[model samples]
Target: MHAALNAAQRTLVREIATLGTESGVGLYIVGGFVRDLLLGGAVREVDLVVEGDAIGFTQTVFSRLGGRVTPHRRFGTAKWRLPRELATACGWTVLDFVMARSESYARPAALPVVKRAAIRDDLLRRDFTINTLAICLDAERAGVTLDFCGGAADLQQRLINVLHPRSFEDDPTRMLRAVRFAERLGCELAPATLQLIEPARAHVAALSGDRLRHELQLVFEEKHSANVLTRLNGFSLLAAIHPALANTADAWLADKLIAAEAAGAAAEVCWLLWLYRLPAAESRLVAQRLRLPVRLTAALQQAQQLGAQRNLGRKLASSEIVSVLAGVQDWALAALVIAAQDEQVRTNLQRYRNDLRYIKPLVTGHVLRARGLAAGPQYAKVLARLRDAWLDGEIHDAAGELALLDRLLLQR
Candidate 1:
């Protein structure tokens, strides 16, 4: 276990143990950090649970570590953003401290009501067995493994077992997380846990849009995100969130997601591609249902509009092609490229991506003004003509641009 940690992590663990000893509080490294450490996966984030004041513990740690500490009073959680120098030296940034607490759901799919509790109770309240594992960081018991729920056994068996049958009922988001974790870790859901998923599908809609969107974003972040989507589709969980997803878009989502990642596009681009075939109103509905950020919704709308142009045929002039794709983001354009089934559309998109998208006019507004062109609508017209000429390969240099500009002015 000690060999799993690098020098920095071991140092941080010792520091935390010392602090726990001084404060007379039980401290342990819990959840993903311990699970990943046991799995020999890269442990990037540190999740600490404390039997005493989490916020006060983090403040004291920050005083010695020289990091900025942010506290959430409501949840008794605090996060420390390691100082730049330390982060540079250690290759870690943030550390989270949470009060060891038990949680209960008031109703199906509602947020958990938390209360301070013992480490055993806290571990029992977690979503999955593997995540319930922890390592004690007290001075006397430092490095001791706590596996009350048989988390290490489940981890060894490569299974995802919910701590309780109502785990998904309490948080339907856990269903999505189960798919994510299964796909991410190459594990399977325990049979009992898998049996509960279908019944829990009914409670999915009770979740907030923000929570749904957040889990979906994590899905996209996975390397085999398509597998997660396929798993969701199989369980009818995607339909539970929004029928449109299953009815209209699920067929192509997995394929487009794979292609989008292959093309090095952002997750939002994959989302836009997923919903690209929906009509304007349905697109708006999906955006609202997911509570998508304004920028992404606008990009989706723009991609849909650009896709509707239908004028990007092979015979179109370079200037017309450039005009069609002028302001579209690379990721959005990549979405369009993947979504386009027509050979002509794909060809045109490649043209814009490879050649015409980078075409810029050599003559700027300042240069045009210096050349006695007034700053008015004609300035735009003249510049557009120059840019068109440039895109068409008719102008190659400043002199060529000037010559084209002179010709346009003469024609005008």
Candidate 2:
């Protein structure tokens, strides 16, 4: 346990213990911290749970630290956002405090009801066994782990096992949580836990778009994103989340996605590439269902259009390559350049990247204005023609640019 925490974290634990001891309430470092420690995973965030009046405890602690505390009396919860970062050689720590409480989910999609509960009860009510482990912060039990749910054994086996079968039914988001844990930890779900997913698959549709979006984003961002998606698809859960994706993403695309995932590619990039094989309408619908951000949605659209044009073969004119490069972000365009299987297409993209002519504007609005052209939207047309000529190698440098500008200015 000493090896699990760094010197700075040890200081935090000791300080927190002093406060809990003074108040006569037990404080424990619970949930993810313990699980990650036992699994030999790096702990980036720690959750401290106190089995007492959370609001008062939070206020007292905040006052001691000279920080503000906000209490939610109805929920029996409190939160303190540290004004300053805890200085640590490893990294500055940002701490938050929460009270131990039992939660009751009304419906799969509805919010949970919160009530103060014993620390053990708090641990027991969590979604999974591995996340339910806790360690006492009080002097007597300091560092002593509390594992009423057999989380330590599960961690030893590198398995994901939920606390109960109703875990998913209570909160459909846990289905995605299971996938994230499996992907992030490189672990597999226990057999019984895996069996519980399908029955609750339909309940996932009941989740709000916002909730589903957050969970799905985590799925793609995980190290095993491609594998997680494949597992979800195999279980028939993908359709419930995004019916359009399941409809259009065939076996070939799935294989591509799996390979990309294994290669340690970014999830967003892999997703965009996979969506390229889909029909435009289906892809748009899937993006909508997944609530993807506007930038990513645009990237996917551009990649699809580019993929379509790639079928036209290696003789892509300089204009087409320039247009493609201009529409995409540098990273995505670079990835597309590397992923291009056709020699001609790859060469054209590389040429656009390396050649000066592809980037130099043929004409500018200032040039148009200089030729007695009115400074309005029509100047845009003049610049576009000149730029097109330059990209097509009709213009070589400033002299050619001036010649083209002269020609456009002579017309309307």
- Over the stretch 1-412, how does candidate 1's per-residue lDDT look in tens digits? 6777778767877887898889889999899989999999887577899998999989999887788999998889999898898787667788889999989889999888999999999999998999999989887787899999998999899999998889999999999999899988889999999999989899998989999999999888779788888888888888899887774435577678888889888888878877888889978987898999988888898888878876775567889888888888776778888988788888888899998887889778898788777789998888888888887878789888888787877776
Best by TM-score: 1
Q: Candidate 2: where are CA atoms >4 Å away?
A: 20-25, 52-94, 247-251, 258-265, 310-312, 329-341, 346-373, 382-412
The local distance difference test score of each candidate is 0.86, 0.74
How well does each candidate superpose onto the true structure, as a TM-score? Answer: 0.93, 0.79
Backbone clash count for every predicted candidate, in the order shown: 0, 0
**1-412 in candidate 2: lDDT tens per residue?**
6787788767766877899999999898887888888877787577778888867887777777655677777767666666455543435344556678888988876768888888977998888888888889888888788989899888888789998888888888888788778778777999999989889888988887778878877776766565677777777777888776674345655566666666566767776765666688988887887787888888887776776684435676777666556656543554465456777876776676668234657466666666678788887666666777777878889898887777766665
Q: Residue 301 in model 2: shift from native, Å?
A: 2.9
